[model samples]
Target chain A: MFNWKLLKTIYLYDGTLNGLFTIAFDCYIFKSIPSNIIFEDNYISNFLDTAIYIKTDNEKSSRIWNGLYNNVSYDTLYNCYYAFLSCQKNKEINILKYILKAFIDGPKINTMLHIDYVLEVMKLRKNVLHESHRLKGLTRLSEINKNLFYASIHPDNNVIELLGHFFIKRFPLQNLILHDKNRNLLFLYNSQNPNNYEIISSPSNFNISNYSIEEIEFQNLWKTFFKNISIKERTNPRLQMQYMPKKYWQNLTELK
Target chain B: MDIQEKLEILSDAAKYDASCSSSGSNRKNSSNGIGNGDISGICHSWGADGRCISLLKILMTNCCMYDCKYCINRRTNAVPRATFTPREIADLTIGFYKRNYIEGLFLSSAVIKSADYTTELMIQAITILRNEYNFHGYIHAKTIPGSSQELIDQLGKLVDRMSVNIELPSNDSLKLLAPDKSKLDIVKPMSYISNKLENNQRLLSTFSKKRNFSLSPVTKYQKEKFVPAGQTTQMIIGATPETDLKIIKLSESLYNTMKLKRVYYSAYVSINKDSCLPTLDKPPLLRENRLYQADWLLRFYGFHADELLEEKHPNFNTFLDPKCDWALRNIDKFPVEINKASYSMLLRVPGIGVISAKRIITARRSFSLNFENLKKLGVVLKRARYFITCNGKYFDKISSFNPSFINENLLMLEKRSTPSKNNYSQLSLFENSLPTKGDVIKCLTGNF
Candidate 1:
């Protein structure tokens, strides 16, 4: 364990929400502010500086979470969580600044959107949520092996948790497994554990789950319907690309 | 014909409908069913034309008896016509829904045999989807204008929403374009559906055990079920000489009196070479978009249709959006204080949307907001900076409220946001079409 008391300029963590929160807890306890925060995988020893390595502790993170929940507005907590979900580079520093501001100015710091850190966090949260909402609609479920409904998406943000909660309410009885292949996150939900889904992370490891015969036939039918539905005279691909961009077409059943 | 071929013709025919929204309906999948209606409709895919395909918008048949000149499937046209069996439609809907290809079904038909027969066929197809299949998904059915009230009532009870197209804006346009459709024949079903929805709400309010059922619930035990998503209508713009003033006035009446959920404006596509219809290479899409913007002003923004347009200025300006145009005309309301403006006043600003306005209201309660705060609150500072003040300091260098000065600068800002039609640039070397907003409006009016 690298000594956190050395007063490092940059703190490195494992790039988890809890890890970020633990770093925030250290900043408060040490009464020293770190200039930069980066993920552990991104950290390289710069001979000009001291480096502090922090391990994730759920207890410490939850303590900070509970403190915010009791002190600040619930909307602020959600904002912080959503901002953390953003795939933007160097988001750790943005979220850390927001947390520090939240501590200094009380819970109402979120209302001060003119503050650079608060505004950036808000923008990042909006991006995360906007992509989540789009994926909820664009998510296509296919049946695989016995009864599992499987879907794969490659959203910019880690939105599988958001998509999982949406599908759980939408299809409460069905077994579901949504894989965010971009982040290698797997969300598994069954009727037995419908409300609290089990999320696991690994490499992009799942094969195409052995699609049922009906699934293949229906996907072909969907492609047929997608082709037949468009008007020949009014074909405008620009508009379609505007709504559903080409970047999102790789995993889409109809587009594929 | 097989199902695939019939689907091609029917889906092609149904593309004219702008009522593709499956919103305002909520339901749960039944024990045996495979689907339910989403509260906010989901766009499973966008079509090549950029329209969202929320529902399986298809017609029961392309067979028609009436000779409406604007219609692609008019009786006079020699296009190959096809019809889908009720079983075929039901099968297609279920098959597609299970695969997540659609939210539900938007089943419509041309006048088959008679109005009653066509409506009955639609009802039969929907009935199979609802009763036989136990499908609880969103179903938006089109009511044949002159259908019997009994059939309309049966149709309304089965689906989540219904519509009766008002086809033309005025009686004269109907007389000229669709000699077979009388004004009475079209409006009768609209009134019937509107009255039925009101009655259903009243009965539910009085007798419903759960008054918290603001969200329409599809339970087997409920006694009454009307079109919970309500009714919507569409009018073919640019097909007639009706001005924007006339179009919105009719829309206002429909919204105010008939209790319509929405009024769709479809830019008229010049399909067949008819002497009555205007010749156009493309539909008046930008004009249609402008009318929709004005329509939003009426529905949500608390602006009257008269305020947006009147007899003096019968049409909307092609370059500026309606709200910005309204704000420019009402310059006296400008320079509203960010910390002091009312919600309505804040909403009237060009770049300040509903979300930003709400944020402004809430954020100001904590501190007196400044220009930086306004931008941070999601206000489009470029457009909004002219109309708003923070701490009594003007962001833009403007001493006068002259509309043209502001209008010109605002157009420059708008020009950045919307791509200028390069189609004009390509034609400029050959034809000296003046590149002005007026010329755009003139071109929109079919003067080209």
Candidate 2:
């Protein structure tokens, strides 16, 4: 019999969902527990512990995913997917433990909030969903040219991938690009291909300074309207900051 | 005047209306239009007052024909007046909509010339946006009281939501403060829009049922809706001598009789000084906040007006929230067992809201819940600990069930959370302490 409890090891992956799931597959095959799961780029050497790099495998990851689907509910599977996309610390290992526990306990593990791993995964999913929803409303698009519009956001989580479906369906006749400055990523949508959106790496020297001739005037009008609409008698800066935090003010037009 | 100056004067004048919501409409962009509506509503930004700026709330014109006592844009007030042509209004809305600065337009007017003429101008602007620009976004149009029923019907078909301000709560107050307007004028348009909306819903339901039974391809835009988001009304708080009980009773009737979507309460900021208006150092914001809490209880928490207030206790307690107050008044109903209580009973608890109650229902189905499980399920343990029991066991810290004991602890918690110097001042034997402007403002805005 394999003594899985005695063998504690560290795992490294290429920061992809398939790679993460491959680690889960290897753990169950070798009957060993991961002490930590670190991204390949962020990994540092520790001489006292054993570490192994897990390559991404398509068949093994899909097999593990199919197993989870048959055992757990769709909401549980999606929660794991969303939580994995979060930039939280030690999220990969936390998600791995959650999936392993789900396989043993079945779908009821989702409602077992008393379990620490289950609750952590649920919290991470909620955090990512909340930021994506807020950005949907807070994204301020500017007319970069006659046919193109642009918006820039610096969110705390990896949420830009979640906004494409909403914006594409809402603006089917317009071309727009949503840029995530912190992650150096771009979500580009064109009117010709309204049904599809493309994600690309943002160039470091992207020019955002060139605006259409009438853009400045409209921006000024928006700022004026924003200023005059607030009642002076009920100016609660604390409440305002609570709703739109100070960190998001850098990209908002009216706040600047 | 330039568009910049016109927008400034008009939006400033329209600021006191106090209705900024842009939700509850599910209109879609079916015809390759420029915009669509979200059913849950999206707030694009927060104002300095912490109000959601969901729409570009502006007026067609600030030129008024009536001299109401409490209005900033009354005939006699010497504020700058401006009017936007229909073309300018349409252009501004599309520009703002394309850039995502607003969800849509909130078009109101100040009875320029007459009600019919003002409604005509608003209809023209909306017509241009809907037909000419092919914009399908949310539009909330304020119906001018006493406008012709035909004009009201026309305006209703083009907008997502409509409202007519009651201005004052009581007939006597209306007669004294706004002599030119009457209660019948406001109610006539409100009932007209209400009946029209009901008929629209009936027609749409039958149409949908027929289409569902027969699977011929049916377009989504089969019928033109009449105020798809329904209608709402507003009344100025502290403008009249009506008690909170009277106001709440009126709101309950409006929700029942008129089938109104929302009833907004605006704290009367004393912008215009008149003998008919109550003289205040600032607006009664605490009273307004209390009224909103009571309003929520009426709408969502399955509460009646009389259950919250009585003739003797005609107002809400300034420090305690309405739900906590009600829970304490009927203490026998509480200390509800978490595992055995029904969903509605759980909602009656102090800290368990609709979401938490539903969560409890879901979480309890798998395993019997304990206090630790309850906290993880998003119940505010600080407040719910006093009212609920886990597995027939009360919280460990709560030694007594005396109402006064619980009240004292809750008050202490409230004070600790909102520690304000103005609310608790040290008195001196020899010197007199007058309220500074800052203290007065804090007291008015309900910071404590």
RMSD of each: 6.0, 5.3
User: Candidate 1 iRMS, in Å?
Assistant: 2.3
lDDT per residue (tens digit) for residues A144-244 in model 1: 96667888889999888888877776566678888888888889988666557898985655767578997787787677778877766678999899999
DockQ for model 2 equals 0.70
lDDT of all predictions: 0.84, 0.87
Q: Is the docking of candidate 2 incorrect, acceptable, medium or high quality?
A: medium
Residue A202, candidate 2: alpha-carbon lDDT: 95
User: TM-scores, in order shown?
Assistant: 0.86, 0.91
lDDT of 1 at A88: 92
- Deviating ranges (above 4 Å) for candidate 1: A1-12, A21-37, A48-55, A64-71, A96-110, A143-148, A190-196, A202-205, A209-213, B29-33, B131-134, B200-225, B412-448
Residue B120 CA error for candidate 1 (Å)? 3.4
Positional deviation of residue A81's Cα in model 1 after best superposition, in angstroms:
2.7
The residue-by-residue lDDT of candidate 2 on B1-448, one tens digit each, is 8999999998888888788888898787853778888898888899999888989899999989998899999999999989999999999999988888889999999998889999999999999999998888999999998899999989988999999999799999999999999999999999988898888877777777787676642343334668989899999999899999999999999999999999999999988888888888788998988889888888887889998988999988988888888889999897899999988788788877888898898888878998888877778887778888888888887875668878877887788888886766667887887889998998998654
Q: Which model scores highest in DockQ?
A: 2
